[model samples]
Target chain A: MTPAAPALPPALDILGIAVFALTGALTAVRMRQTFVTAAFFALITGVGGGSLRDLLIGAPVFWVRDALVAPVCLATALLAWFTPVRWWQGQLLEWADALGLAVYSVFGTMKALSWGVPPAAAVLMGVVTACIGGVIRDVLAGQPSILMRPELYVTAAALAAGLAGAGVVLALPPALTWAIAVAAGFGLRGAAIHWSLHLPAHGGEE
Target chain B: MTPAAPALPPALDILGIAVFALTGALTAVRMRQTFVTAAFFALITGVGGGSLRDLLIGAPVFWVRDALVAPVCLATALLAWFTPVRWWQGQLLEWADALGLAVYSVFGTMKALSWGVPPAAAVLMGVVTACIGGVIRDVLAGQPSILMRPELYVTAAALAAGLAGAGVVLALPPALTWAIAVAAGFGLRGAAIHWSLHLPAHGGEE
Candidate 1:
């Protein structure tokens, strides 16, 4: 199907990537890694999810072809390095991450749909877009993935992605649907992070 | 590039995926996971690298459209689950892994070159195809990735990919070039495994 919705604005896309890249650089810094590694983390965390989505959907990798993406990641890493890690404490990073999550989830679903992926797969693409970068970052840092702890991360993403996919399939207006999806996803994640809510774990196994 | 090389035989491709898939399933089994998780690991490890390569090269994902790939991975997972984990503690799996690595490395580089990626990038594509699946598997399993170890795995992949790319650019015959690339890659990996060789790590980093 032809893309019925407007393309995600390039500025918004850059902002989301920048925020995620900041978090990635922070992860590296906290690990006492070198500058090179910090840059590596930032780039991967910024583009990992989108790159995966592009790959899975048989599209060109976004960051590789885009002139601005790598520079943004690198610049973010440098910014993170110069700033003290302690300065990043509190809800600011969390809120930014939630924002990025919201934006990315919807964007991912839209891209997937445009690629002719099934509705269900498009929803999953949104979650992957919003979350897999962090997964890769966590894995690289040798930390337990946030996915294992059963926080509401994936659920939040699914909500946004699902809504976007449903909205498109139902022929709803794009702007209204995207707004609701973002708000819903961000709200859920915010509540989870603030209240330390966790999904129930499987008994007898970990 | 007219894909001067013939496609890699389908049987070899399936066998390679199967061997890697079994290792993935074994990791899940060792972690005391359910059959579902084992199957997940198997599928991811089997297709992870090739998917990454295709994404980078802007080609449709190979396994997504293939009918047989998922089934083979699932079958391998089932086999791994039933067999004694101890039975897998031999040189057989290692040999199989080396073989898969050799084939995947060459295949990845060729695909990238065919997609008009530069030689350097094509070499990297080879390494990604041969190694990233295992990386994803380890990440999902929450284990330290092989990238952290001083193994010659990536190096062997580089050798094969580098040679293959070089050979093609030099106008070598396809069949002979593929054979040499696979043999050299496997030989390097085999030597590393048999003799416990490792690339030197930074002294301070461990």
Candidate 2:
């Protein structure tokens, strides 16, 4: 595979890491954990999904090789530590998370495709990249993962990943494909957050 | 750096996978999930830790490459599905888990060291290898992870990993080192289970 998709712009990538790291730090902060715990939460949450994806694709782990990633996560954790919880509440963080989720999912798909993972598996990789970190954060924090709920969180990620894979198969312009994919994922997640949207619960039946 | 330790015997490795997979299946069974869910749980739990280790150490994922591993997990899940839950209740599973944890941790350390991971990190790799599968199982099942408790679980893994690392440094015979490391880990975990041992809870303080 000769680079079917270009790499994510560094600015958006760092923004994604920061946003995820903030959410992680907030989780620990809400739990009244120590600064160390918050920092660790930040680092793991920021890196978890991408790390898993890289591992599965037989590539070197991204955060381990990237010097900036850990420091960004740590700085985000510090920012969370010093700030009042109320200041970071409401739509702003949700919007940022939505953006991060979309961009990260698309980027993950592109990376996997470039690595020659089958397109179907690559889409799954994108979902893993977008969502596993939050799942891990919830798991570590002893909270119910959003994946366990009827929420549209994972569905939104699947949409992004699926669209990215489709774009690659169609041989669309990479930039246009990525932009559209990100917008679609972000819009879905944003709508879910705004409208309190969710999938129907699993009906108890045979 | 050379591979200072030999691989875990295949029989013992398969046994470890089977025990871990059984625990994963049992978690889903008790939750009243379907066979498909149980199988997924078993497969994930059996492979989760080692997969993470391989990814971190830049090695090929073991289960993805090995034909026997997935089939073993699936078979374990099938056994779990058909058997009455009570048949698996009691100390039997715990003993098996303890054995699996000990052996897996040692094996993980050996693999990481062979892969050029630093000794301290390799020890952590061992703990990750032993504990991560169970952690993932609990997370997916929405139960509180054993890691969050002040239990001797991780401590036991650390002991095994640490001892394995020490043996490497001391240039001891691999077989003797592995035997002692596994025994020490199992002994500690076993004592903890029998005595309901736990580390003291973190005191609420500034």
For residues B78-105, could you state the per-residue lDDT of candidate 2 as single tens digits? 9999999999998999999998999999
Calculate DockQ per candidate and list them: 0.14, 0.12
| True-vs-predicted CA distance for residue B183, candidate 2, Å | 2.4
In order of appearance, the predictions have TM-scores of 0.61, 0.62
lDDT of 1 by residue, A1-206 (tens): 33453367899889889999999999999889999999999999999999878778766777897899999999999999998787899889889999899889999998888877777667767877888899889878988765544677877887898899899999899898899899999999999999987755322222
CA shift of B182, model 2, Å: 1.7
Stretches off by above 4 angstroms in model 1 are: A1-6, A204-206, B1-59, B63-135, B144-206
Residue-level lDDT for A89 in candidate 2: 84
Worst 10 residues of 1 chain B by lDDT: B1-10
Flag clash pairs in model 2.
Answer: none
